[model samples]
Target: MAGQPTYMLGNRNKSSRTRDAQSINILAGKAVAKAVRTTLGPKGMDKMLVDSLGDIVITNDGATILREMDIEHPAAKMVVEVAKTQDDEVGDGTTTAAVLTGELLAKAEELIEKGVHPTIIASGYRMAAEKATEILKTITIDISRDDRKTMGKLVKTSLTGKGAGEYKDFFADLVIDAVLSVAEETEDGIQVDVGDVTIEKREGGSVLDTELVPGLIVDKERVRPNMPKKVENAKIMLASFGIEFHKIEKSAEIKITSPDQMQMFVDQEERMVKEMVDKIIASGANVVFCQKAIDDLAQYYLEKAGIYACRRIKKSDLQKLAKATGATLFQDVTDIRPEDLGSAELVEERDISGAKMTFLTGCKEEKTASLILHGSTTHIVDSLKSALNDALCVIGVALEDQKIVAGGGSPEIELALRLSEYAATLKGREQLAVSKFAEALEIIPQTLAENAGLDPIDKIIELRSQHEKGNKNAGLDVYTGKIVNMLENNVLEPLRIKTQALNAATEATVMILRIDDVVAAGSRKGAMPPGMPQPDMEM
Candidate 1:
């Protein structure tokens, strides 16, 4: 507590009297929603979001777009969380979830001002969400295990409008196969534990040669060069606990009766040490993980024979190593490596537990070795460990999830659609929240359209009108916009105009109702800031 602030919030106000300001929060949440929903389908266009730093990100991925945005309103942050939650749950469909949530919030705001309580709006929304999920499930197609064609379609469908390249089918199939190999049937859902499937790229290594190892392998050398350079047909012993070198009785001390007796004691010690070494060699274990000290003579003998001896190996690593190597591991070192050396880096000898491990392999021979570290700080090790974990997680995701779509604007459009549907079901003014949410979804497509030198508002209107007449698709249907499609008489996917119109109108209404205050914290006494003031803020 010494370094902590004695009185935090010293200059901060505990309360504000802005409730009477009669301003509606334009619902940054709603805005985000509107921006995302404009590009809901294949017809969807991309968004170009440029931040204050002039950094530009062009994407339609809802999660990425919101993440990149410079949002200031606290309410909008809640919308962002909705997207985050979706990402956590499905690892995909985040944009769709977020756009829906934003539209819901926006519609709720409108109905709230129309004398409807937030509770009713929320209840209805909960019901609708459940219904929507049910609807999706009904429409969801069942894919056959043998239907490689459909699988290809699914992958291709997932990759549509994604990064372009050659050999996409090959890559997709490879990813799919890897994922399918680990797929496990469970009662709740299909479970695939991909934590161990690592996808790594070396500077000069081919992707095809990537393989899995039973245990960890590193590229390191023995702790000491003086230790055995190599051991032939070696018996390996692994242990997680330490041991004692000298034995003692219940109440024994250093009190020798005679010089002869003392000499005998010394000889006994030497015999015990020699017996231990002989047992290891006889057992055919060339590698031993020792938790205790080794006698100088035994160490010298082992070193001369080119046996691998490691000390202070972590218990976790030992267990994994043992499992991989199939070597006999115990608290005591009497057992040796069995007929099978097991697929392990090496049978290590160590005292400590909870240390991360990497096995170093020989370039020519796949011989396992250990690098006994001497000195290092905690931070350096921890950082390295974290980096490894991140790398591993990314690789695992790639191996397991098998796909990643463009984020940012793509998701927002979906959110808008879901929110617009909710708005339609609302009974009263609280539906305004859903409307606001829908409006928020439009920002991206509109921005994109505007940037492309087209009339975004007019396009929105056209899309909305077409969508209202039971058109299932409208907004960003990209494929239908092609010149070849026109010649081929390819009919465009119908747009859901009613929902789009509702989203746009509600956003406009909310934005107008919300523009009550124009406080510029940086300006005072009629003085302007360095840069040109916001056009909207100018009186």
Candidate 2:
């Protein structure tokens, strides 16, 4: 009994050690990569994802596809994380990151089969990733924020390969305008918060009907019919407190034993409501956006005062209003002062698609903007919004970093060439990993060519030849199937997209490769409760 080895894990626990674990994990990672590989470039196809509830989402956006997938394997989930990280950091290139991660794992599998250690492969990947990043920085082209032409190209590049591609030029101008309108300059550099740019979508019109608002749009209307439908030179007050009577915090009951006493109580409530409305008027606020309820009495009084009021506004919308109009949000009406009010050129209630919405345009300060997108169906509008968001993010990233690179898979080809050269200078088996990393990068161009119905091998050969001939920007044109200079063709993206994708892919791959063991506890799904009878399986 003393010499008997004790089981380190629970009886219900299952574990795969070393080679078995690595094999299973690597295969899972590769499978996930293959799932989204086809959704790669401009010529990529969309995937129709249906959830358990029967809702469907069709898109080529890698982030969306992987997110909608119900993945079970832990290693496969890591690949999905790569796409998510890319999307969060750069707002684009999710597919590229995912595909790259799969390729890296594929290569690592080869190394593992050849008796190479996972640690050695991971170290080589780290070195290759660092070298690839350096290579990317060397190839980036600097552009001034004032160069709208180049900025538009960057936006259009992100918009391509989706439903929005057909209207890229139109959407590009709108995205750039919206981003620059809210762009701020600080000690650090140009900072662009895409959150300041709101996107509102509606059905019933064509995508061309999309327009950018220089300020904000609230999906609400005036609280009362008699109130002014429009207010010029608006002084807006954002109130978190409701105009309704304040309720007691603790549970209590009032004893109104007589009709006279009940009337008196009602009169007192009216006075309180009037006083609350008076405070808002005294602040020189002709327009009120309340985050909570507005009483009937308060509404009547506000309408009589000719103030445009909207009740039950969302807290997020109120904050955006504060930013757009330079207004301060006041939780207590008594604390509101003339200085706390925000100014807008005009506040108007407009009927859009038979529904009333408030539009606040020409803010005192251009700190926020909005885009109203129109499409024939809800699905179309959603896809358009997704594409526009990606475009907006890439533009913001480009403005913040002021660096761009040729798109159309040009950067990947260039990175592959430079990394291969860098690998040559390294010694030992790590160089094999480095070279594999280089080869893995070529998967982008190959996938792009394959999706476009072109010969992937021929295209890669041509691209490599062009790069070797000093044509670093040469990329395959998915439309014409010709190798051309992406920079000259006006195909470009922010350098951040490529860097973020590479870092995320490498990190995910290295993590999956270093795994030597996997332990899974028995699922508790149908397990009987303690002391409960187990279901009979004899039948």
Candidate 3:
């Protein structure tokens, strides 16, 4: 019998595999990154991404765009991951990290094709990154503790045009202080607890005060004169949602076949309602915060009894309100509070066209301790809460540990350039990765050109020519509609967030690239990906 033999492409036999995983990752990462990067600098244009649901989101925010898009490629997934990591590390800066990383991989691909080993490139990249970090440190100015001016600028940037108006100055100081207070003062940068607190707009107005109350606020006084007139030192309590507790035999109404039985059920219900309210009053709870579900009888009795009750309290806003007023929550009225009470001016809901509820209790107008609401719509607010929560999780990280970078994109750019510069200095072909890194640095500018709809090729050539002629600071310059020198004048530098993001994205990408294959610990066939060398042993 004649046996057929198979030949392998490049350097492999039929049974042998090469770790082209890095190549694929780098390629995919760079391609998508390139597409996104083109939208950088002032020249960057907006992208309108419409999801399957026809929800259209338009922005150059890389994480947002990538997140909303229907991305499928595994490598592209990694690129998105880079953006995600950037976003996770800092509230802003995902785009720059993705852009820089994609360019790095792109340049690395060229070097790899030219015979540079992936390991060599990785090592050089590592060196360049370290150098970049050092250079960035030199440029970073510490935000003075008292320099409220710059701090105010950062806050204003976060709050302005978001319906914050003259309130910007007021809320800016509040937000900055709250962030600073939550975050530790360190040489690296100010740490902040970056969670999104709920803000609601209602028909009632808002109140600003720090005095803690021990009871609920009701629109009317207690229905009965016998009901205590505002129990002094009332213990305030909250509930998950509003509901009256009344026990009934299983299917009691079904068995009741006569009017007398029905009347008994009604009377029992009334009695239960009264008992719960009386218990709350007896517990010395002068106030209660609950969702709008008070039984009519309970409401009538509570009003006559003089309990301060605020109904329809948003579930989300309860936490901050609780924190601000020192109120405790109870599922049943029996668990009322005297010490849990807090005070707020009458709960007035403001009907701003968009969303406009600014709930501040126990803090002066100029003082910090305010919530900034993003994504004003009901759905958008929910989504924004999740996004802001992710941001907050990152803040938790800051709370738990000292972060390495203060700013995001600017630091990332600085780091990328240094890594590339160091690669240029390496002694041998190993320097290929370093040089590649430097080449990757071009991605930022290249992306800017792409986003601006300008000729990236031409801009690169122009920048290169200037650099070769002795322009030390040769980089991409993007403007609204044209390619301009970033160094030319008055170009707003990337935010501090990008720096931290770059480090995280770079690390994650490199880790994924360095691995030939991912092993599934427990599964049939060991969960090995195709076209990569499997681990010597499977778990």
Candidate 4:
């Protein structure tokens, strides 16, 4: 019934569009996987990324590497999205997600060439992914939420090869405290909003100088030098009102019958600002944080009232202060009450990197916290922050889910073993696809071994043998290049990390495999300047 595929019916269109989309996409996926494969385990190497502006970033993080890269291929970009989704959902295992997705597509492409339909391969992959998830549950080890030591180990595992090995213990403590500080318990489970942990970077000092503040820290300096430098037992007032005069909407010159009339009008504007300042003073607020600008007259009055004030504070900082200090923000300054005011044990201005910053310390609320990140250079600090984010996210998810699995490539190998056994129970072409899925998952351990400078073939064989011998937690030890108990070594990751990785990797692979045709329109004329001719284009 077919004279050829519809994508090939039109001679001109057929030449422009890629007919073998499966092969093209699989190659693109494999290309992207190779870019990040070397950055896998404890001994993994770092990628040095440079932008057009000559800004350089060196790291082994999969999310950062993909984000910084200038990827042109559409299929490769989709693979990059898998790492992004994994980073967003679980904050770790981004490399595993991307590599697994590429391997899945690579295996499926082989099946397609062997006369298996893409839909069949996709369904097999979907079923295998589900089976993999079920197998994950069998290997996960329950971790007590009360175990800080083990939790520290979990965060350290995330930070091991992230170029923070020296400060793993130090950073782990801060990350755990920061996450737990903002973690909220809901009816469904533990809810974590990492945004509650404010990270302010300053280029000075060293990494060891970084510490956690019990409250929010804003980069804003005091509005006036005459304002108090430090206030003990500070009463904080959060005012959303723009502590300034409202300019007349229309530009008009008022006819003054006399100088007294003009003076009265001028004095009235001053009175309005004075009234707002008096309201704040009456509320017993020793420190004022404003989201909007403060009129010069208001500043003069506030300084005279012996109150410290900072204007133009960011809205995020204002909300964080509200949570940390138990303060209520007021729309109108006149309606402020004592209960509406927040308090900090001491509100002081400190000189950080030669710039003044306000620190609200010893707040009553544990719902918000801040980390002052310090480093001798911006590059180190930036990479350190990314590493910390991964750790914080993983710990948050682990505590929320209350479960973890052995890291160091153990879980993937274990899943591969279980999936292969399950695949043997299937029949037909789907069985071949399922078996491919099992083989594809072994890439994690293999890459880990290769990155750690060990023989991947030998390592994978050793891992398979250990699992066959009923060592469920057996995994590749990158440091020793042997199969050991990952759980006993405390190489653990959050359960959602693996589950989310599987879900994302499978979704991306299926999406890529089902693409039978790719049609690209010629570049727009307006996209280039006039008189510039386009070169020979190909899909």
Measured by lDDT, the strongest candidate is: 2
CA error at residue 432 for candidate 1, angstroms: 6.6
Write one digit per residue (lDDT tens) for candidate 4, span 352-438.
887789988888786778888888888888888888889889988999889998888888888898888898999867888899999
Q: Write the per-residue lDDT of candidate 2 for residues 174-208, one digit (tens) a residue.
A: 99899999899999999999999989888877889
Model 3: weakest 10-residue lDDT segment is 208-217
TM-score of each: 0.48, 0.93, 0.67, 0.89
C-alpha RMSD by candidate, in order: 12.8, 4.0, 8.4, 3.9
Could you tell which candidate, 2 or 3, scores higher by TM-score? 2
Instruction: Give the backbone clash total of model 3.
Output: 57
lDDT of each: 0.45, 0.89, 0.52, 0.85
Candidate 4, residue 283: the lDDT equals 88
**Residue 335's C-alpha lDDT in candidate 2?**
90
lDDT of 1: 0.45
In order, how many clashes per candidate?
Answer: 85, 0, 57, 0
Segments of candidate 3 deviating more than 4 angstroms:
1-23, 152-191, 196-236, 246-254, 283-287, 291-293, 306-315, 331-334, 343-360, 363-421, 424-430, 449-496, 515-539
lDDT of 4 at 48: 96
Cα deviation of 271, candidate 3, in Å: 2.3
- CA shift of 503, model 2, Å: 0.5
